[model samples]
Target: MKKDVILELAQRLRQAGISGEVVDPEAADGLSDLDEAYAVEGATRSLALGAGERLIGYKIGLTSQPARDAFDAKEPAVGHLLAGRQLEEGRPVPVAGLFQPKVEVEIAFILGEALPGPHVTAEDVRRATVAIAPAFEIVGSRWRGGARSLPMLVADNTNAAWISVGARTEALPRDMGSTAATLSVGERTIAGSGTAVMGDPAEAVAWLAGHLLRSGSRLEAGDVVMSGTLCPPTDIKAGDHLVAEVGGLGRIVLDVV
Candidate 1:
């Protein structure tokens, strides 16, 4: 894609984010490939950073096979997480500023050491981790009616919106793949295991590390990497109270207002 086209697409997406409006997915048609899509994402990241938003870490999306299939993605997608978008546990999330918001239960990995990679492994991810926490990833798409193509989705920053994290634990779980997660909204509840996220949450992080390295970046120490969701995302609305529990990690509470 041409540089000007990439910038224009980035600006369109950023404006959509600012106005809480949805842009036409066709705006991303100029992207020639996933690489170009990520270039647009990079441009949007630059725009946010230039606007004084701090980059906290990154989030991995479509780590589950079903999620990948839904978006026609061959692999997971990555997005930058901004500090300003992080919500403290117990704080109410205002739905008025979001577009098509949904929630996912995830395990957050707070890296203790940098994982600069081409050779990063799940074990390496484990070794680098200092703490893990139960988290709620509140995702929203800026593309009208949601993203229609992988390139459009990636260019929209994988629909990242906000994240509410709970307490962190330095003690590693016995077997992350076996770790269980349960999310409840009002009277309904959904559950899944860490295996849902690319067989193991750590493996998802490992995959993210390699993906980042390929794109000239790496997971740095203190970065909060959201491995992926444990189950399918659920729609959220105003006055909704959500609770997510990750066995051995603890729980996080989110109240939508």
Candidate 2:
């Protein structure tokens, strides 16, 4: 894709995020591949940074094989997380500011050491972690009718939105892949295990480390990485109170308004 076209799409995405209005899917038509998509994502991130939004960390998307297969992707996609988009625990999330938001439960890893990887492994991720927490990722899309293609989705920052994190603990699970989690919204409850995320959330983090390294970036010591959702995303509405409990980890509470 042309540099000018990438910047133009980035501007469209930025405007859509600010106005809470969906952008035309055609706006990303110029994106030809994942590389181009990431170019647009970087451009979009630059625009946000210029506007005073701080990059806090990164989020991994499509960590499950099913999700990867659906998108014809061989690996997970990455997105930047901004500090301004973090939702406070126990605070009401304003629905009016979001566009078609949905929630997913995830295991979050707070790094204690930088993982500058070309050969990082899941065990490396575990050894470098300082804490783990149950988390709620409120994903929203700024593209009309959602993203029409994988590249389009990537260009839109993998549907990044609000992230509300729960309490953290330094004690790591004996078997992260076996760790379980349950998400509840009122009387409805959905269950999933860490195995759902690339068989192990730590492995997802490992992949993230390599992914970042390829872009000349690395997982910093203080960075928080959302290892991807354990279960399918559930639609959320105003007045919805959601709770997620991770086995051996704490619980997360999010109220939508």
Candidate 3:
């Protein structure tokens, strides 16, 4: 895609209130894997980067095999988180701008200080964290039926969507990295787990911080990176009452319509 084309397409995505799906001329060359996906994510996020909005943090998903298999894809993808997506806990997730939406329960981080890039350890994240908040990532897909190609999803912002975070917790849990839990939609329980995310949530954040640093970026203070998912993402419909109770992090709830 030409520079103008890419930019225009991106605008359409933004204005449409949903990530845009593009058909790359050389689809295979556009993106080969998850790593490349983030590369494109950086390029696209640049559209919002340095625009006066501060980086909050990062979030991860697809920590479970079933979650990965749910997409029938390998590796996992990341997104450039923005403060705009941070929805208050118990608020209804706005659905007007999403397509083929879904939800994933995740542990969110509140950084205490700016994370220096080039290399950040799990300890760095722990030390910088002000609190560990529970959150629900509203995931949407570029394609119907939950399947997408590598490049397809990359240009689609890895299906980036709204993120609803629970109240902040100051007393971080001991085994926050591997705390098991359950996701509930009102009385309808959906999925549950903890260690499913990269075996450790802290490590996931560390890895992402370093990964961005290597690409000439740094994890900004107050940035909320959504690490990979703790359980398989469950599809959701409007009017559904969503609840996620990660044993160690308490629980968070949201509804959509």
* List of clashing residue pairs for candidate 2: none
RMSD of each: 1.2, 1.1, 3.5
In terms of lDDT, model 1 sits at: 0.90
Error of 3 at 18 (Å): 5.3
TM-score of each predicted structure versus truth: 0.97, 0.97, 0.82
Candidate 2 least-lDDT 10 residues: 89-98
lDDT of 3 by residue, 1-257 (tens): 44555565455444444334433334334345555455455555666665544446555555556656766657555566777767765568866545678788888887778787667777787888888878888877544333356555655576777888787888876666558878887567766555777677877788777766766777776777787777677778888888788876778888888
lDDT to native, each model: 0.90, 0.90, 0.68
Off by over 4 Å in 2: 97-99
- lDDT of candidate 1 over 71-95, digit per residue (tens): 8789999999999889975688876
Model 2 RMSD vs true structure:
1.1
Once fitted onto the true fold, the runs of candidate 1 whose alpha carbons sit more than 4 angstroms away are none
